[model samples]
Structures are given as C-alpha cells and as structure tokens.
Target: MAAATASSPLNLLGFNRKPIFHCKLSSPRCRPTFLMPPGRVPSNSIARTGRTFSNPPSYVLTCLVIPPPPKRQKPKAIIQFIGGAFIGAVPEVTYSYLLEMLAMEGYLVICVPYNVTFDHAEITRRVSERFSSCLDSILGSGLPDLGLSALEVSDLPLYSVGHSNGALLQTLTGSYFSERIPKANVIISYNNRPASEAVPYFKQLGLVVSQMLPVAATFPVNSVVEVASGNAWKLLLDTAETVVPNYDLKAFGSFMTRFTDQLPLIINELAEGISEFKPTPPENLESIRELYNVQSTLLVKFDSDTIDETDQLEETLKPRIETFGGKLEKAVLSGNHITPCLQELRWEVGNVYTPADALGQVLKNVSVNDTRRLATTITNWLDLLSH
Candidate 1:
C-alpha cells in the first residue's frame, strides 16, 4: 500500500517515536505507553517539562531553615588588695568593710596580708617574702586552674590596689614579677609614700652619726667641733641631695600637713611615743640605704585639702612613668582617707565612735568606683577570650 510515514505511526501512539507493544491488539486494543530508563532524563529536560507533567508547581515545595548562632562567653576578673603601714594593728573591721563594698559591686577581691612591722628593715624583708608567697599562690592555685573550672583563666583580668606601705610593697612586687605574673591592667596606689624616700629624717641622722662619729672624735675640741659641724653639714647636704631627687618634697609636704592635721590625735600619739625611740642597728644600715634607692610607683588620692600637693606629685611622676611605658592617674575623692569605714557614724548625735567607721568611709569613697570598674574590665577581657 502507501509508503509508511514516520509522522503517521508516532501520531497514533501519542509519542515522538513508535511504541513497540509485543502483545495482541485485536482483543484489547492495547494502550501504548513509554517507559523512561533510570537516570536517562536530563535535568534540563525535566525542568523543561514543567507544567506538561502531572505534578504542578503548587503540588510540591521546598524551603531551607538556618538556626541562629550561639551566644558568646564573658571573662572573669580578680582584684587583689595590699594593705598599708601598721595595718595589722588596725582592726580587720576596715578590711571587712572594704570587702563588703567590693563584694556588693560584684567583685572577687582578695585582701592580701603583708608584713607590718614598725622596723623598716623587718618590714622590707617581710614585704618581699609575703609578696613572693602571694604571687606563687596566685599562679599555683588560681591562674592555672581558672580555665579548667567554670571560670576560664584565659579570659580573666588581674588588678592590684595597695594603700600606704602596702602600695609601695605592691609596686615593688609588680616590678619584680612583671615578666612572670599575669599583666595587671590597673594598679592603684592609695596614700603611698615613695619607696625611695620612705626613711624618716631622724633615722637618716642616726645612721650618719653611727657611721661617721668614730672618725671625728679623735681630734682637738675646736677641730672636732669644726669637723663635726662640717661633717653634719655634709651629711645633711648629701641626704638632702640624695633624697630630694628620689622624692616629691612638695607632695610630702602636703602629705605631712594633711596627715598631721586629719589625725591630730594619731600624730599626738606618735609624738608622745617618739620619746622612747631607740637607735637603728649598724648591720641593717645597708638595707636601709638600699630601700631608699629602689624604684617604685607612688599613688596619692587627694581630698579637698590635698589638691595642691596631689597636682604637684602627679606632675612629678608623669614624666617618669612615661619613660617606663607606665602611667599615673590621679583621682580626687569627696571624702578623706577615713570616710568609707565611718559612714555608719555620720549621724551619731552624741555617741562615741571608733576610727574604724571613719577609715571605712574614706576607703569606701576612694575605692568603690575603682574596684567596680576594675572588676567589669576584667570580666569583659575574659569574655573576649572565651569567644
């Protein structure tokens, strides 16, 4: 019959090509169908089929959901306080008072107990020994285990605040252990005298007399008088020259005036006690000399009366601290050195009050903000490392 055409057979099967059905067609008129081999349909071809397939666009849908990132961890901060001269005899009430204030501000503060002997030589030795022990304790007990526990050491910050002699001790300790211990972000010195000039004038005079008097007495009276006076003048001159360069005399003057004024009773007590003063030993002379020569930081917080002296001391120390890559920040407080511990007695109508309250009030006024800021700074630093 007519020549078989490709279009005629494909149109009848409803496919582009003829379907191969190997079954009877007369009894059932078999329906033609096309089977797609596995993976035979190209992705592009399936995509092109689009609406032509039985499944419509609305019949199937897909979506992706990404969870938000976790929050970061914050760091921990530690504050160490070194107390000042004759701190041992002073009641622990003041220490506890300060601790309470700092604790209220959410600071973990350690009040370090240092050597507080009246003898400078003994004080120096005890300071050195105690400081070393404290440092060892910090590294061994606290720092090493900080990261292992809930508190991470890597992110924690360390700070130190010292008062009077304690301030001097901490400055020396900080200098000595600068390379070994963790860096102290903030170091506060409270009412501290310079270590380079801590020795009193009377002590210096005694030291000179004990050292040079033997050589002078083996001469004529006039000669001895002349020689002794000359030696005395020389000693005084030398001491002045040596001590002036190492200390801020203007600051010292202010300190002496305020200290002498604020605690008139204490000064009176000291003056009365001076009548029983004894001579310093010859063997400890060198130690005394060394103490005056050692370099350390000096911090003095100023009240209304100490403003001028505070300024002078700050100006004097600024250049020196700059040279050492350090800084001196001066602060003025609303109360004197004895207010923080004494607030409880502010409204005492006629009751007798201990100096502890006054001392606490002063400390509270001076250190409350500082302690809190230091704690927050340390916490922030620790948090950064955890992230």
Candidate 2:
C-alpha cells in the first residue's frame, strides 16, 4: 500500500507541506539509555509538501514504527504502544527508554501518536484506524527497512502496552488492531477523567470558543482567504494528526482576514459542531461497563498516583472482559502518573549493550529505575500470555 495521500491546491494559510520529525540525544526528555540505531519513520503526509502559504506547517502524524536492536535476534513480537495525552505527541522521544528497552529485548515497537482533542472516544476510534493503517503499510512496503530480516511476519504475537491515556484507549479497542493482537491487555495508570479535569479550564475554553465563533466569523474575509481558510480549518481540526515539536510559520496573510485571534474556538465548532463535550464524557465512561471487550487484562497502579482511576477501570473492565472469559490482574509499581514520560540517557561506565546504555552499576534516578521496572513487568506479563 502506498499509504494514502491527499492533494490540495494552495490554501490561504499555505501550510501545504509534508511534516518531518527530529529528536536530539542530549535532550533530557529524549531516549538515550539504549544503544539503538536511528529510527526509521514511515511517511505520513498529514500536511502537504511544496505548497508554502506563508503559515508554518504542522505535522499530524499517522504512526511511528521502530525495529529492535540489530544485535538482537529477529523480533519476537510486535509491541503496539501509545502513551499519555500531551507526551504522546513525542512517543518515540518521550517513551524511548521503555519502548527501546522492549526493542532491546527483541520486540518491534510500533508507537502510535495522536494529537489532543476533547472528543475522547473519537480519539480511540481514530487511533484504532491509524494503528491498523500503519500496520498494513508496514506489511505492504516497509518490512525490509523495518529490519524483519526473514522472520515470519504474520505469525508474530501482538501485545499492547500503554500508560495513562494510552491505557484508556487500549481498554476500549482492547488494542485489537489485528488477529495477531491477543485478548490480553496491559494498562498502566489508566484514567478516564472529564475534559475539564485533564485540560485545565476545559469548559471555559469551550465556552470562550463557542462565544467567539460567531464573532470570529464576522471578521474580514477575501475570496482567496476564504478558500484558504477551509484547508487551514481542516488541518487544525484533524484529531489524528501528529506533529513535530517545533516549526517556524508566520500567521499573516492579507490584512483582510483576521480570524487568527479566534482560530482555536472557530476551528472547534467547524470540526466538532457547535456543541462542546468533555473527552470521555460521563456517557462514554458509563458505557465502558458493558462496551469493553477483551480476554485477559493486567492493570497497573502507581504507588503515588493520585489522579489515576485504576479502581474505576477495574470495577468496569474487570466484569466486562471477564464476562467473555477474560481475566484481570493488578500490579503496584513505584512511580507517579508521569513515570512513563520520564526519559534519561545512561552514561556507560563499562561494556554496555548499546553506546546509549552505560556499563556497570551506576546511581540511577528513582524515576528511571521505576520505569525500567515497569518495562520489565509488562514484558514478563507478555511472555506469560504468549504461552
């Protein structure tokens, strides 16, 4: 499969360009603990290329696929993963320590990315679609570059590992992207709070956006600007789009169009209709009691995570998946909700696995150590389920 592409004429915003991602080893938030080669990111043109409308381009990513360390044997399984809300935008960099550690342990890691939106259930649906699309694209064309090296692709077992919001998503789909994905699910620090809780001033933002939509619509517009706003609006409203961290795009076109001030609110109504709802509204969470599907689930709770709703997940998902002959178990790990978001590069003291892993025993941060333990526990559960 060529990976779907859409062509559009130049719009007023002119962000018509493909997106590229960059990560630095020295960044405190980037992965550097494992010795791994540069990642091979497949092309996902959420934005077009060759059209510069004077606006800085934003990338809404489809997905990122990473091969295990070459020194390791062929990948044992495909670990389909997603991280939390904001940090998930940089899954490769944010969760590199644990994800690459899984790769180091000989599993191909497919990290799914999604831009944040208030429509929480819709996020899961879009994530499911994008994840499946990414898998198909990999099987269709990128296997060689993905480093499969003669391993049987179709026969590999699939497991899902998620932290925080990622866990909430996997809970809904059961991470059921393919037949390869088993009934077993691994959920860490699962939370399904209202948009008002996850996003500060959520109701206020929605209210402000609603009030400004009409006023913003009355701002000046030209024929060229009107045509361009449609494209710009679509890009802004695309919930599945993933982006690189930073880019430089100016926000000025003809002085005639002044919608920039109300862009956030205006785009919401354009994309989501004028109605405002929280992410995983009460109705969505209420639906989970009967809507969840799975066979076996491993729920993880952190020692100090106050915001986590593992108890709620257990109360809801345990019965749902179990009704279908599934089992649910829980583990308490030492860390907060943000443990998975912590990144570190270990300095090798002796012979380390990769240049990234420092050798010998060193004083590791408690958070790094906790994350390492979390990775170990999930992989252990995966190994057990594989049998």
**Number of the top candidate by lDDT?**
2
User: What are the per-model numbers of colliding residue pairs?
Assistant: 18, 14
Q: Residues 90-128, candidate 2, lDDT per residue (tens digit)?
A: 564467677766776777777777665555667777777
Model 2 ranges off by over 4 Å: 1-61, 145-151, 175-182, 211-281, 345-364
**327: Cα error in model 2, Å:** 2.0
What's model 2's lDDT at 80? Answer: 79
Q: Model 1 reaches what TM-score against the true structure?
A: 0.39
In model 2, state the lDDT of residue 367.
Answer: 41
Local error of candidate 2 at residue 204 (angstroms): 2.5
Local lDDT at 160 for model 2 = 79
